[model samples]
Target: MAKEHSLDLIAIGRSCADLYGQQTGGRLEDMLSFAKYVGGSPTNTAVGAARLGLRTGLLTRVGEDHFGRFIGEQLAREGVSTQGVIADPQRLTALAFLGIRDPDTFPLVFYRENCADMALCVEDVDPAFIRSAGAVLISGTHLSQPQVFEASLQACRIAREAGARVIFDVDYRPVLWGLAGRDRGDDRFVAHEGVTARLQEALPLCDLIVGTEEEIHILGGTTDTLAALRAIRARTDACLVCKRGAAGCSVFAAAIPARLDDGLTGRGFAVEVFNVLGAGDAFMAGFLRGWLRGEPLEVCSDWANACGAIVVSRHGCAPAMPTWVELQAFLRGGDRPFRLREDAALEQLHWATTRSGRYDELMVLAVDHRSQFEELCRQTGADPARLPAFKALALRAVDRVAGGDPRFGVLLDGRYGMRALEAAADHPYWIGRPIELPGSCPLAFEGSADVATELASWPYNHVVKCLVLCHPDDADELRERQERQLLRLHDAARKTRHELLLEIIASRNGQIDDHTVSRAMQRLYDLGLRPDWWKLEPSDSAAAWRNIERTIAANDPHCRGVVLLGLSAPEEELAASFRAAAQVPIVKGFAVGRTIFADAAEQWLAGRIDDAGAIDDLAARFAALVEAWRAARTHGAPADREIA
Candidate 1:
């Protein structure tokens, strides 16, 4: 297929933003908070297929607003081609507000009054884009409108001309067809001959037709399942897949069977359902993932059912779609948990695979010191208010050293370095904010007891850094307390969509065994706390680094590599440490503070150096450290620039 086509599938239809109510088992009217996600059937399918390693694209129109740009950016991040996605300047992006009141009741409100997705016109359909895909997927919602109906039909014609398969997902929505009230957006079907006739026009152009029983009833003009299948059979020779909810699904590629299960069938999971909103889209995506590869019908059905089951057990659709890794794990046939979302390993893979970023080499500056700054101010008798400007100056030094580089990051705190964080966030620099209170033995957040609430005001780009001085040999009570705190912070990070970077040291008072630090990491993973990045102190030997990396790889292979933390060591010692670290591939880079800026900051605070001198000194020191790191990673001679 790759030799003949550039893409596996092209999904054409509505695209919109979904704002889901956060209050589960609560009425939509009483919901307090919400989370935004990119939604719509074809958009979800494209994202689901892309996450399963399929080359897919979307053909739709979004409003020329923040949500529109957001949809485009998110699709691109999900590995779906957005070249065919156009923006309609005259309309606002569509939005859906949904709530889960019970297992069966999902109250939804769709804000799509002349929305952007419905603005897709015939002129927006590109023949080449449709032809390059192995198949084209057109949802039934787009056929309800005049302009988009013509555009979807044109795409089908192009696909037919190019010998590429055309797939029709009979995504029947009664409210969308004007058969229900505006507030009844969740209505599945209505006995409307007009809507069925409109859908029949597009069915004959399809090579594969997928729909639920009610949807087939809408398409085939009958309430009886077999009669509806026969009616659809008479219109086209395309394969028919009838979803049977929790009973699984049946696939009939030839004649209609005497009974539904008499045809080829795939078994479904016996797990409980949460929200049945996006399961059908997930089912179609899973079907195409196998169907495009020319797999057997039974295999495709199994994948389809499993995908649907997975999504039905989760909250949001696009974000809840299972990746290839998670699918494989679930299909292994074992005594499984009651809910797929409760599987730690599966959830970890989902979080890791869906994350969007690249930090091949993260060279971050460590300036998120709180207690140290206070001590410096106390010693120098300088006003505490000067610290914000000092931190801003520190950022300027980093800017002069490395401007707008994604690899260069700084760790700052909101208590003192909020101004610097505001400035650094505007550029492309990777930024991290520390939340752990300084000198807290068992660990505590710097501000409110509710860490998650405190992290709400942070920007999305700012990573959450927590310094834990945990020793494996510590008393069990103390260790348990520390682990509990770590779990809370980890949950907060996930809730806020911020990456967590754990600085795991044996103890700040002195050096414990290097092995103890590695053991601490393993224990954290056992608690189901998988941090994205690990910040560790430099090891004395290469073997220690190997063991540490092995522990991380075994627990969560998707873990971002480790960063070497500078404990304000001497310049010569740090240079030697960097050279030795070159022997380990897991160390991405270093996050050093005192080694690069301690002496310079001290001199500036003592009035021994002006601001310009301090900036010049910090920049040169940082640049030299960066060069030394490059040399170590590249097998070049160790750099000789002095910092002390």
Candidate 2:
């Protein structure tokens, strides 16, 4: 039987009231539209673990004010035991102002002057709590303050003594420790230099060290991820896990070599991102989940990838976390198809130009018989001249799916003898184009390099290559051939200073084995090409949709939008409730089939949907419906109505 208090994760240090303001192209003093959310690295980790069904507790200090109450309540609601959370009546809670300029990054300003969290002393932490937990997790941020820092260190020591593993997250913030206080002279440069020194003090005691590439560099003074991991590992017996953001995570343990001879060492999974905030915490939560379950290091990396993927695909931190059911569903290939709106489409075009690195652009080439190609083009409203460019554009589109940005163009042609395009239909870069084959012609293009280079040169930060083979005889051959083409494309794209994405799509029900696809993908990994690939049957789409619908329906308050056969009262109710709970506008709409419905809904929600030249007509309609309901309720009130 599992222990009575099995696998309790105790998270300590640093709590803050994170105030976020959306930039509306105005000055900082203009009183921008702002939103407040509770934030703290430890708080986030605790909540993340709890959401994953772990017995978790948070030990931190907040002020006696309303913000402290809010933080306590938020943790409690997330199923995190806040018994160890203390309120400091003498000091105020820490405050951090976060400004979101884009989904990938944000600007932060901290206002923590002797904050309550910093007032935490060694006597505050309950020894029983430390002894009961399976692991005690702490962050390096608290080390800036002596009292709180000592308290956190002592707690970790106590937990370790009580037979609990110690997990240290080196979340280094230069500004926090950069201030020229009395004890440390006016050496302004000391703040940045002090981070590594402080981290070194805590390294020997930590059982595990989790950090990003940047954090690793700051801590170990090295840019190379592998070298940093080894350097840190040599100092402590702790396992070193370095997060590479979009590229995935690299894990190193003493028993395990840095690289495998069979080339099966660092595991990776490409993720679709919306906001990168709290992604590290999500990854830590995931890694801890696997570690608690006694899973292998590789599986642990996969969990971290899955958790980080889910968190970054949403807006906020705690609210964005997926439940255990949602994670399992996603792992089981139950994610819905990509959807796009006009604004997202335009943003993709803009993002393509502004961002640089990987091909943020996607290209989808649809191949099918004559009748299928013609019918698909007619249904999708794709143009014939743009058919050749559609494949590259669609591949770019898939990268932006997490942002709900529509960025691909569709085309229809009858040049190839195939019926429809052989591409992932749900891929963002796929343009829903279907080309009819004229007869057996040259399937391989002599100037494929030119096309590949042009596609790679798009303005997007990341480039993705998607290949879908619908022809039975062409599947195996196409898979190998496409890999070579992608490598060449990747080389060309890199020459132009862009990141290349090469994805292969196959049917799950087909003769192809998943291990074969994994092995093929592993080869790409060896070439430093980490791409997203999927193998699914035709009916997999419906199953994915059903899973999404169920998730939306069950978590109504958390679900921001609903896609059904068409807009209905049920969807409206869900949207209304989500808006009320999250305190943000909610979207309610539907897609007819996979393509048509998703496109329309994406545009409508993004305020780009046009019906009779009216932007957000569907959204306005829903708003009106909600307004009328409010009016009816107001009118239904009897005179005086003072029974209560």
Candidate 3:
């Protein structure tokens, strides 16, 4: 297998829609809705391998419907080559409705009769494409149908002739095989001699075979595990891998003994399990990732186990797969205790790092302050009419700071001042719009009562920023109400595909300590609020920032890094904060409002400075902050430059 080749692995099998029930720990009858995600053994493995940095492709058929289109889109998003995946307008895509019973059990019903995948024919198989891949993996279910079986065998022959390794994943599902006199009670280990004989015909052509213990039982035509291993060994000289859930997986080379004790075992990671359905696919993808990369068998097993551990602790199969960086981070995280909330951050990293052309770092302009702007208006006794001019002045500051730098975003409230938001809409600058009401105690929205409904209409590229004034020590009733509102906002943001920025301001009256802000973050995660970005205040110490990072990892590993809030700090002090924040990798950018635009805004409002003069001052201040932030990132030093 040459690394220079285009495709590393091409998977052939079923591709379907997995309707996973949203309500955990409940039966399907009790669930009202299910989140749609791409599923199927081969598809999941392909997606997982792609996420782990493999140049992968899929050779399967999907229906002409949206589910099929969704599967194609997801594969494309994950960087998988979908040129081989055909669309069958004659048949619909397969579907599986899944429900979580417990950590060890998940109930699933397969609705795949004359599905598109089963309709695959010999004519659909691309010989040249299969030959180009370093390896071709075929799922066992493909052999159940005579037409698809012929196609699978043809792909295998073409791949083998081209010197590509042939791998078989015995994804044995008893219900899919219609054999009379079969004990339907046991779906795991159903032994039929006819099926075993049929599977054996393809075994001699395989260089590698993978299956769970029960799957092996069916493939070997024996209930005894050891007898099954021996039977497989006699049939083929291929490498065999036995998947043991939570106990990890074992690999046996052709020269190895049939017994499990003789095979190489990779210790499994100990983590809280939410669903066990997709763990096998994740493990297979991980194992192949290591094997295809020419890594040692032991290292492959470790990758397999770690990958499986990550999927079991989350939701859907393909979406839950970790990228190479996330896997490395998890392995490097050591024996430390990990919570499920923290997995979101890693998931974010997995999704973010795999994509092309993301900003290396961001230098966002902070103009999303409504309460402070109103306060300035109050202090100067200026009419609220002048606020629009002030906001217009802030736009000039954004333009100056963001000049020639694509890594800049502006946060402005559309409710208070629409001028800035409208001006920056079609501009190159990244825009984030605030949805929270000005000076709300437990949080309130200015427009429609439902913040989610209002935000649903916002542009996709515009980030929805929510500013919440919360305290860890707040009264229980107020905290509960706030949590409910925040969860509603979170659900809406996810459904609308809008990136969210959560700005949490600790209650001003409470005794502020290092742990206060981080604990506030953890509380939101506990209530199911996973924001893409967290707008935070400058921390007092290095240890405090580390605690915040840990908190982000636990609650939402997918969280974009935090941005430091100005809290109306003096320009010199805010500069120092930027230097401190740049030292933290988890701090990607800054969003400081008053420190950048306050002085100019006050001068313009009080009639001490003209409109042009105020605009110039604001732009200079904003540019100075941008310079200080870049310097802090490039050179490790405090922001010592005076504000001109």
Candidate 4:
């Protein structure tokens, strides 16, 4: 292998979306919805390697559709290079709809029949880019088609010629071959002489080969597992890994003899099985991590086993792969009190480490309160048609803060702020949109299920900010239902690939204080609602913030940090609150709605203030808050004081 390469690994072939039904223990026909996640073996492996802190890239073709965009964005988010992931404008991206009918049977249907991935041609293969990789991983399915087969071989040959190791993942999928009219039923694994011949040609060039027993059997042209291993060994001296589900795995390198009970084997981490579909891809990713890092054979196997164990017990393919920290934590201890599959800490670690872009601390402008603006219009005797103008004020504020301050975003709604959102979409600025009704104490959504539908239509850049009017003192039934709804919203946000910014407001009917807000947040955390950012009411004291921070750290330290909310207070009052919030390091910035725009909006609605005047006033108010926040963040927290 080359001593230096631009990429640690470049994975080639199929990329698709895996929509796994959340309703487990049911038929696909009975399921109402499925969770969308990035799928395809090579794509998963690339993402997994990237998650393990490897500089990886993917070589594949995805349709010009949203699913293809999602796959690209997801890869980029995981720090995987997508230079070779071509966007085929004519074809649709492949999809795999899977359902967990039981522990053993996972109902899967492939939607790839002449899909974008299958159309991969040698013309699409960039030889120079392939040569830059330390290793090139060729997926077995890529060899099913003549064009993709040629492309895969071309890339592999180029990488090998450049002193790059060629790794072959025998990711045998009978359904894919069947689509090519080469195989029968996907469930029936038969060793085709032609397929074996093609695989054998690539095996001689591989430095490493990983596969399940079935995959190995196909490549070695035998049903007997041992015979297959021997045949493969005779053909090439490449290190071979055989993945045995739950029994761990066995590694057969040049130095070790393969046996049932010996030769560089590692025990698999025991996990409660949920789905076993993507375990192999996760295993390959883990193995690549250890191999590239020059870990011992046993350690590499352990890493592979750990990754496989974690993914098998989770939901989807690439998303289920563990981060480096999560893997280390799993290796150190078993899933313990909180199962590793569902551990919030591990989830947060993935969230924190897998950031796609780097941005400075946020300075958000809140303009997403739909009902509040309507109420203001009603009180001021102005037509509701003027709401868009009111929202434009917030956009104007955002424009004013643009170049001068880099860390600014606006929280607007599609209802009143569609223009603002469309405009912001053209620029590279942070944007948050509310998905809840204004003053529903029980946390009713403004459009209920339609909120998710709206979210689906939005660009990936917008944040889904849901305002749940929470009260610790609310009835248990209401609290439980609210929790359920928020959980649904959280899942929907994840489906749409939007960063959730959960805004929680403690009910003023009770003694609305920091303690109440803290408890409310804790309750949600207990319910497993970990948002990327928390839009919180400003705490009265530093002690209150400390309490909230403790809960956040324990629950999800990967949280993007909290932002103070303005309850339509005066500029001075909001400034005082900003000072207190800025003292807390966990507080990134503020999202003040009324304090900045309510009065100006009201005056504009009443025709007392012109568009320029209203925009100017809103800009000035927003600027004042920004100044206060920047000063507070710079000078540090002030002395502790009691709330008046």
Candidate 5:
């Protein structure tokens, strides 16, 4: 193998929030809601390359505001290095409000009058950072202005000096360059001599150049496609690639040919186009995946076309780009005119592969018991209204225990834990909100039964947790109903891109044995319900734990590990359970709710303890359990450790 570089690519340009209208086939004004995603050509390409398993980085500036921070965090989660991502205190992040009116017509408005990303200047380019990458990608959109243009040139200059490849994406948008109205951000091309002149200044420095037919026209300073290719070919010897929409793309490694199609080319996929906004970026990403690996040009075209085909069929750009696993699966093709968004298997792979927060050991606090909280209030003659604040207090205990580690998750409910959920929106901790109506036997969603819509209203940090008391020995009718509800919830989680943590209690119906839980898991996996996490009762022996692990590994190796449910067991009883699961790697940690918080909550409710006392009690108990779990993981649970 060749000596490796510190990074495969570093994309330089804008990174902002793209608010795509939730309701497609409508006007932007009439659209009620939008799904925000990390966008901007350079960042999109960076994210795409990262998803394709490339070691990528981004050099851009975003405001210190919420959206700006969101872009930074999102890039990091996508596995793109944010070392060059600067937090601009002076300017706010950019936003693009867009709507798909029809298959052909779309409306876009850029909110970048003085956005932070546009402030990228020559000073932001780090020569060492540029040299660390095998290649640097410069988006043409950054060439529209003086500051960003200089930054792009500085990056390109440094890349060439270091013998690193430079990739130029002729990502032309007339509105960005003032050739069109500010609102006409969707306008792909405007014939301007100055824009072409600006692009030409950086052409000699690039190793590979990519653009659409219209984009190439803008760069070549001509209306005719062939003439434009020839004109641009004269300025530099960089390999040219012209994106030809549904015709795939054409490559020119030697010289401009009489017919663009006469060059080495690959045909586009026969998939229906949903939106053309980010296909070019996806194409760039796919191309780089192979190019950086020294793969042949034909293979690169194959990847680029497949990536473009997949993204154009989806809603947003960055999120729609397929990971390496997803791309390879799509390349194995099932049928023509692919409906990628509706391909459940592919979409599932996308979710499984691209998601973050893979904790080495997850220690969750399961405080999402709605009826249990209400029952505690009822027994103590306390107002149910007070439960919300108590739930917040319980979350505070979790916060106190976690100290901002993402491994410490909280299974909360919007019914009473809304304050906690909303407050922890930006918290590093993993927050799971329950969807199952409390103690519902057959399992029903908490609100409106419209699980998808309910999930959509939830914050991105919230994972959808559903507890079902399903037994392997259930009657036919009951089993079918339970499976149906689970399937519904499963699909809803997929559509909303929410991670699912399924808690199954098999003893709910019949006599329990070690294999019963494994059987229930097998049934769910057979039904194609692959949850991100599993909350299961602790196994009494290592053999039972082995069965559980085999069942999970056989069905879905991507299954995020499991956590043991407390089931209101006493702290002493739970210690033994934790000891049994100590050798089982699948059992990440415990989500013991009542064991940790129930006593304190009851004390607070019955007025036996004040708020400070109750909070201290809860925090102490939670902290003890965490320590016990860690000890068990490290050196096995001590048999003589006294209960708290």
Candidate 6:
């Protein structure tokens, strides 16, 4: 087949045979009934871009086996030009087994060894075809192997030399590199060292770099979005784009000569997500479409966010992507309401809780409380008829706090031999479960003894600190103990090479002492320990800034980074202080928590919390806060520059 003259996009990479299964139960061992689907980043991007009304072509090498035929048929069905895809008789097609265990966790197992995709050589990609395309989209996974790496880089160089814009998606997969014989040692899968090295080589030649916040962090070794952006911009002139699932996307461009907006501004649009599997590809497709149409960067981001929102509401990758018309309709209309039955919602919550590392059986006790409350309402003294109204009020309370509604609720007019026909509500014990917030690393406990072990056990990449409830009167003592414990834990973690985290409740203490901090740092150094990052309650005091600076200077080479949690500090001073201290490059990133949990707890404790409405509000607010923090970091003056 001959190549087309002018293509909107030339997506070059792997085409895999996919095996998919939907989870019947929340447990990992639960028997799952699954269905097969076509999967691969390159194929998905081509299909996604085509569905968004682009004339897209795919350039890859596939086996002459049944999987290859399937890939060809799927691409043709999706309207992607596949003339450039080559069929290799020497190798078998790559295969991937995908399991959607629940909304938050999806596990994938790949069987790719000397696959046809890796068989692609420089000759397989046509120089003239790449030159004819408006943009060339390359996946980072393919670059793990030496043969494909060289070939893909050659294609990127050819496209660049031809004046074509190149888009690089840093889809880092440690397994893929391992298959290529790269020994990463202890930092094997999680660190993604090989992929980062490859990205460094390709990034300088590309016009755009598209990656998730996690991917960027892995490549740049920082969770701060702006730091990641600056790191990439420092190496290349590509328009840097960082994808924040559900919250939105950010675009950073260098200050050009006489360009409008200077491309340093950041913006976000809200999104409702259902299945986040291929949302990134959808965003890339939408962004490319907008960029091709000469739209503003902000509008491109909005379109990308809209497209991602549309896909997450549906199931699967290619099947979920909306056509250009559907995307337009969705944009014209408001947010799509989630259509979930009560049973479905319950099942989802159950699945979410089970897979969420944050919540264990002990922490999630609301189900039992609801059952007990029902029995109490059935007693003789209770007015059974008033139970319904009272239950409604109690339900409102559960809606007020973080993870409150789905995991808890209230019942009214319980009999329990009471003379008055009154309603009752109870606070449920909270089990902290790991949550993967958009645009940040998976959170872990600050003072955890086995950080790596705990991180491995976590279902997702990020870990948030568990709530530490200390009595107001004992706050000072608790703070002191926590500081002492943190020092000991830091020493222990260094010996074990585990990441240490220390989370202190700001509302409990009202303030932190320098003595405690000094002792903590001294102990950290004594044990040869440095944290990946520390999450502290934001403060404006000179002491806090000084502590941060000193800590970063001391642990510059050893620590991953430091992040200031909670958005209570003055933004101007915080930024200024961060920049001044960021003189050391190893002081990688910064972040702030939204205070959603605090706000929700305050409402629940104050008797103003609503059960039914709280969960969604909390999630939305949390997502919004993360979006704002990321935006500020992206657009904030360089960490070395003082705030004006």
In order, what lDDT does every prediction score?
Answer: 0.87, 0.55, 0.81, 0.81, 0.87, 0.56
Give lDDT tens digits, candidate 1, residues 41-103.
999999998878799999999999999998998998899999899999999999989888898
Roughly what TM-score does model 4 have, to 2 decimal places?
A: 0.85
Candidate 5 Cα outliers beyond 4 Å, as residue runs: 1-4, 335-337, 639-642
Q: Give a tens-digit lDDT track for model 2, residues 1-644.
A: 53455447989888888776545333334536455667888888887777777899888889999899889877876778888889889999988766544543455667788898888899998888788888899897888788878898899899878777899998866667765443222121322556667777888889888887778876775665566566676678888887877667767676435552222234444544555777788888888888877888888888778788767765556655656655665566433433111222222222232221122222222222233334445666644433333322333233333233332322322243112233333333323222112321212323233744454324332333233333233455655665565556555553443433232333421555424333444445455442221221221133333443343333332322321221122434433332322221221222212222233333433445334322233223433333333332345433232211
Candidate 5 at residue 611, lDDT?
78
Query: What is the lDDT for 593 in model 4?
Result: 80
lDDT pick, better of 2 and 3: 3
Best-fitting candidate, scored by TM-score: 5
Per-model TM-score versus the true fold: 0.95, 0.51, 0.67, 0.85, 0.95, 0.49
- How high a TM-score does candidate 3 get? 0.67
Worst 10 residues of 1 by lDDT: 635-644
- Segments of candidate 4 deviating more than 4 angstroms: 26-32, 179-188, 255-258, 335-360, 396-400, 403-407, 413-437, 440-446, 449-531, 539-551, 608-617, 635-644
- The better-scoring model by lDDT among 2 and 6 is 6
Q: Give candidate 6 misplaced runs (Cα > 4 Å).
A: 1-5, 24-32, 179-189, 192-194, 255-272, 339-644
lDDT for position 164 in model 6: 73
Give the residue spans of candidate 2 off by over 4 A: 1-7, 23-31, 179-193, 255-272, 334-644
Report the C-alpha lDDT of model 3 over 1-644, residue by residue, as the tens digit.
Answer: 44355899999988999998877887677887677888999999999998888889999999999889989977887788999999999999999888886775677778887999999889998887887799999988779899988899999998888888999999888777775223231256567887888787889889989999988888888978778888998989998998988788778886556567678988888888888878889999999999988999999999999999988888778877888888898888754445543555565565455433354577676767777778888988998777766786677767766775667878877756688778876567777888887778777776787776687667667888888888899999888887888888887886555777898888473876778889999988777677878888876466778888999887666566788887878867777777766777888877877777888778888889997888788778777777777787787444467755
- Candidate 5 per-residue lDDT, tens place, 191-279, comes to 89888899899988888999999999989999899999898888889889999888999999988888988998977898787887888
On TM-score, the stronger of 3 and 6 is 3
Q: Is candidate 1 or candidate 4 better by lDDT?
A: 1
